[model samples]
Target: MEFYKLKANPKRLFLLDGSGALVSAFFLGLVLPSFGPLCGMPKNVLYLLSVIACIFALYSFACYFFLRRNRKPFLRGIALANLSYCFLTIALLCRYSQSLTIFGWTYFGLELFIIGILIRFELKYASVR
Candidate 1:
């Protein structure tokens, strides 16, 4: 689909974002610590980020439900938030470049890619185009 013309149904977009956040929260918060050291990342930092992800997930769910009436801003907010996070993660990855394993880098790349896609979708379709 052409990005300029692409528009996602608000409900579906919200569902997708909320679901992704929740899943990431679970994996990062609950499952990642055990493998952190093996992956060369600090367990404490991983743990902290995981908890932050969980908080984000909870807020996403709230936004999904509460922002239905005021959707354009909501969508914009989600996109901007994701964009900021994507950039932040990239910075963090760079800072810890020497510590991350191949798996860690690959995962970071994928995370950035997915979030970028979401930002694009939201920016393209969230407005009255």
Candidate 2:
């Protein structure tokens, strides 16, 4: 009449993903706007977009890290949120053609790489149950 429980170690992969998301958000929110004019972008628009990006980034990171230690539902919710932000960022960058600057391109590439790795990690461990 007793129930058993299962637990898993904290995976560093998620941490990496969280870090990447933070960096990306910082780049898009703070770094990008600060240099948007130099990059030949409209400062007002870019800065506004950067603000939005930052908000999304912070949300993603919080969701993941906050729940990663104890709640599976929260962890999954945050992971999905992070993934959504990743996709949205990519789409926004492509739509606006703002990925031309060296810094912009590099940040985008790093985010994509992190996202890919996160996905692979999830798939690899999908059968853990």
Candidate 3:
């Protein structure tokens, strides 16, 4: 087993992450309600999570602006914000497990996985190297 360090161009990382977050925000908020219950989340919870995704997407874009400015401190703040959001998401999912249907759980599990990956990249690249 080996621990490989995450490596990438910081600016590119922000751009790609920003794109992904925006896409997720779109699907989570706009597409889900079209076929209610398919998402396995209660209507209210679904809307709430969708709004959160939108906010996350906005923050991701903010990260891009920070990267554009070459401001290390703001980039660090974005990374920390991402970390905090992911943790909060996981906690919310766990606490609301009872509200989640099978599909809901699966969807959120995948969300956590992707967030975990992105957060790793952010934390790694944001650190002194």
Best by lDDT: 1
RMSD of each: 2.6, 7.0, 3.6
The models' CA-based lDDT, in order, is 0.71, 0.54, 0.67
Candidate 1 local lDDT, 57-124, one digit each (tens): 66667876776576778778788877877777778888888989988887768877887887787776
Per-residue lDDT over 17-85 for candidate 3, one digit per residue giving the tens place of the 0 to 100 score: 677677667667777766687765656666666777677667767776754555456556666766776
Considering summed lDDT, which 10 consecutive residues are worst modelled in model 3? 1-10
Lowest lDDT sum, 10 consecutive residues, model 2, at: 1-10
By the TM-score metric, which is better: model 2 or model 3?
3
Clashing residue pairs in candidate 3 (N, C-alpha, C atoms within 3 angstroms) = none
Off by over 4 Å in 1: 1-8
Candidate 2: tens digits of C-alpha lDDT, residues 98-126: 43666556656776676666654544443
Top candidate (TM-score): 1
Model 2, clash count? 0
Residue 68's lDDT in candidate 1 = 50
Per lDDT, what order, best first? 1, 3, 2
